[model samples]
Target: MKPFPKFARQALALMIASVPLFPVAQAATAAEWPTKPVRIIVAAPPGGTADILARIFAHELQSPLGQPLIVDNKAGAAGTIGVHGLLSAPRDGYTFLLVQKGIVSEVPQVMKVTYDPFKDLVPLAQLTRQGLILVGKPGLPARNLGELVTYIKANPGKVDYANFGAGMRGHTMGVQFNRLAGVTAGAVSYKGSPPALQDVMGGHVPLMFDGPATSLPFIRSKQLKAFAIAYPKRIPALPDVPTFAELGFPDLKEVSWMALWSAPGVPPAVLARMREATLKVMQSPEVQKKIEDLGMEIGSAATSEELARDARESSERQGKLLRSINFTPD
Candidate 1:
C-alpha cells in the first residue's frame, strides 16, 4: 500500500475527525426545534375570526407536530398588539400569528404599526375566505343594495352602522361603502361581531358589514336582511342575496381571507413542515365541513413561496388604495 503525502494525510485526518459532526449537527437542529409547546397568537378576543381560526388550526396541528399548540389571545389595538407580540418572539416557527386579511393588508396602511406587515412577517397559508355580508335591520324597508343606497342617501347622517372594530374588515367595508356611495353614516365600533350584530338587531344600529359566519344566523332567522355580499359571488348561506359586483359596485367586492403567518427568519425546513401540516388540516373533510358551515369558503393552502408572492401583491394593491383615500391612523 502506498502512503499519502504530509498535507494529504492532514486533510484525510481532518475529514475523518469531522465525519461524526454532520449527523450530530443536523439532529441537534431538528431536536432544538419545537422543544416546547408551540404558541399561536390570535390578534383578537375569543369568538372572533382570528381566534376561531387559531383554535381550528391548533386542533389540527397537534396531531402532526406531536406537540400541543397553545393559542394565546392578545386582543387590542386593532390586532397590531398581538401581531407585534408574535413578531417580537423568536423566529423559530414555534410562534405564529393567525390574523384576518384586513390586518395584514389594510391595517398597516391605516394605522402606524410598529412592524412592517410584508417585511416582518412570513406567510404560512390562507385557510379560508369569509366574504362580508351587508345586513340591514329587519323592517328597515331596504331589500337590496339599491334600496339600501337610496335609503342611506335620503336619511344621510341619520343612518347608523355597527362595525366589529376600527380598522377591521367590517369597518373597512363600511368606509369603502360610504366612500363609493358618496354618503356617510354614524359608525359604531364594538369589541367583536356578536356585539355589533346585537346592536344592529336591536335597532341601535340599523346596518352592519358582517362576516358570513357571524351574520348567517340572523339572516336565516330573518332578523336581519342581507342586501348584498361584498364578494364576487353570493355566499352559500345567503344565496338569494346579490353580490356587490352584480350591483355595479365591483370595486367593493373583497373577500376577507384568514391566513397564518410566522415571523421572518424561520428555517426553511420548519416552514415546509408547517405548510404541509396546514394544507393537510385544511383539506381534511372534517375541517372543510366546519369551515363551510361557518359560511367561509375553503381556499387551497399556499406554499411559502406562493404566500410570499401573495403578500407582496396584496401589500402593493392596498398601498395604492390607502394612498388614494389618504387614510391614516388617528
Candidate 2:
C-alpha cells in the first residue's frame, strides 16, 4: 500500500492523540459513574421491611455515590414483579435491586416467574439479615410459645396464624412450628407484611410470624405480645424475648437476609465501584447502629461470589422445607 501524504499522516496522529486511551477512558467513566440519579427497586410494598431498608440505604448511599438514589416499589406476585422489573431495566449500573433473599431463593421455587435470578442478576452486596419474630395480638391469652402451643391445641380448627405470603420465610416457619409443636393451627396468607401485621394487631388474626422490622414497634408499644423469636440468639432490640431455640424449637431458628443486586452484564468496573460504595456506607458505625435499631444485623463483607453461593444454599434449604410441607401456591 502507498504511504499517506505528510499532512494526512500528521492529522491522523493528532486525531489519535485527542482520543483518550480505551483503558484510561473506561477507568475515568467508572470513577465518575452514576452521574445521573440511580434507582433501587424494592420487591415489597411500602411500610414493609424491605422498603424501609431500601429507603435507609438509598438515603445514606447518595453522599458516597454523589447522586440521588431513588427507591422504586414494585410489589406483588411474591416478589416476582420486582425481580422482573430489575431484570428488565438497563444493565448500565444505574438501576439495581434491594430485595430479600426469599425473593430469589424461596419465591421462584413456588411461584411462576419469567427469569432465573442467578442468571439474570449479580449480587453487589448483602444489605442486612433479620430473624423472624412470632407475635400475638394484645388480647391473646398466650404469653409465650409454650402457652401459644397449648392454646392452639385447645382451639383446634378455630385457631390460625397469619403469614406474609405462601412460600415466604414466615409461612415456612409457621408450618414448621405447627408440625414441631404438634399444634393444628392453620395459616392465613396475606399479600404483604403490613396487612398481615395489621390484622394481627387488630385482633382479627391472633398471631403472625413476622420480621422484627414491622413487629418490633408494636411489640415495644404493647400492641402485640412477643411469643418467640426465630433468631439463633436474642436480638438486642428485644433482648427480653426468648429465641426459638430457647423455646425448645431449634429448627425454627431460620433467618432471612436482604441484599443488593445489579442487572446481569453490568461492567465489572461499575460493579466494583458500586459494591465499594455500598460496603463503605454499610460498614459505618452510624449506619450499623441504624440498622441494628431496626432489629436487623448488618450483612457481612461478602463478595458477589460468596453471596451467590450463600443464596444457592439458602434456596436448597427452602426447597427441602417446601417439599416436606408439600406446599402449593394458591
Candidate 3:
C-alpha cells in the first residue's frame, strides 16, 4: 500500500483520536435527558386498565426522572392510533408507549394494522399483570363456571358475552372456553373494555371476560359475579373464586400483562436509563401495594430482550388458539 499524504495522515490520526469521545458525549447527553416533560402514549380510552396503569406509573416516575411524565390516550384502530402518535413524535427520547400484550400479540393476528410491532417498536420493560375473569351480571342465575356452561347450553340463542374488541385476548379466551366446555354464547363486541363493561353491568350483555383491574370492585360490591379466573391459582383478592385450572380448564390459565415500549431508533443510553428507572419504581413497596390493591400483580424483572421473547411466544400461542376455533375477524 502507498503511504498516505501528510495532510491525509494527520486527518486520519485526528479521526481515530476523536472516536472514543463520541460515546462519552452520547452517554453524558443521555444522562441529562428529559430536560423537558416525557409523554407516555396509551392506546386505549381512559378509565380502562391500560390508562389506569399508565397514569399510575407516570405519576410515580416523575420524581425519579426529574421531569413531569404525561400519559396521552390515543384510543382507536386497535392501538394503531397510539403507535402512530409515538412514531410521529420527535424521537428525542421523550415519547414512549404503554400498552397491553394484545396490541402487539393478538390484534395483528386478525386485523390488518398500519404498523408491524416487531419492526416498528422496541420493548423496554414489562409492567403490571392480571388474568382475565369470567363475570356475569349480578342477577344471572349461574353461580360458577359449571353452572354458567349449563345455562349457556340451556339458553342457546338467548345468551351472549361482551368482549372489549374483536380478536382481543378476552374474546379469544371466551371462545376457547366455550369450545372446551361444549357450549356456545354469542359474542358482542365493543370498542374497549369500559363500554363493554358498562353494557354488562347494565344487564344488556349477560356475561363478559374482563381484567381484574376493572372488574374487582364490582365483584366485591356484588354488582358482578365472578365465575372463574384464568390464572394459575386463585388470586388473594377474590379467594372465594377458583382458577380455570381448578375448574378443569387448565388451558385457560394464561395471564395478560402490560409493557412499556418505544419507537425504533431510540438511543441505547436513553433506553438503558428508562429501563433502570422503571424497574426501580416498580420495586417500591408503595407502588407494589397500589398495584396489588388493583387486583394486579407486579410485573416481572425481565430484560427488554426477554420481554420481546415472551411477546413472540404469546403471539404464537394466540395464533394456535385462534386457528383451533376457526375464528376469522370481520
Per-residue lDDT tens digits for candidate 1, residues 186-283, read: 77888778888998898889999998888887888989988888887776666788888888888887766788888878877777778787888889
The candidate maximizing TM-score is: 3
lDDT of each: 0.80, 0.86, 0.87
- State in Å the error of residue 287, model 1: 0.6
The TM-score, computed over Cα atoms with residue i paired to residue i, of candidate 3 is 0.90
lDDT string for model 2 (212-258, tens) is: 98889999999999988888888888889999898789888876789
Off by over 4 Å in 1: 1-24, 31-36, 179-192, 316-326
Candidate 2 structure, TM-score to reference: 0.89
Give the top-scoring candidate (lDDT): 3
| Alpha carbon deviation, residue 202, candidate 2 (Å) | 2.7
For model 2, give the 10-residue run with minimal summed lDDT: 112-121
**Model 3 per-residue lDDT tens digits across residues 1-330:** 999999999999999999999989878888898789999999988887788889889999999899999899998888889989998987779999998877778888878877886878788988988899999998898877888899889998899999988778888888888778988888998887878988999999999999898899999998899999998877778889899998899999877888898988888888888989999999899889888888888899888888777788999998888888787865
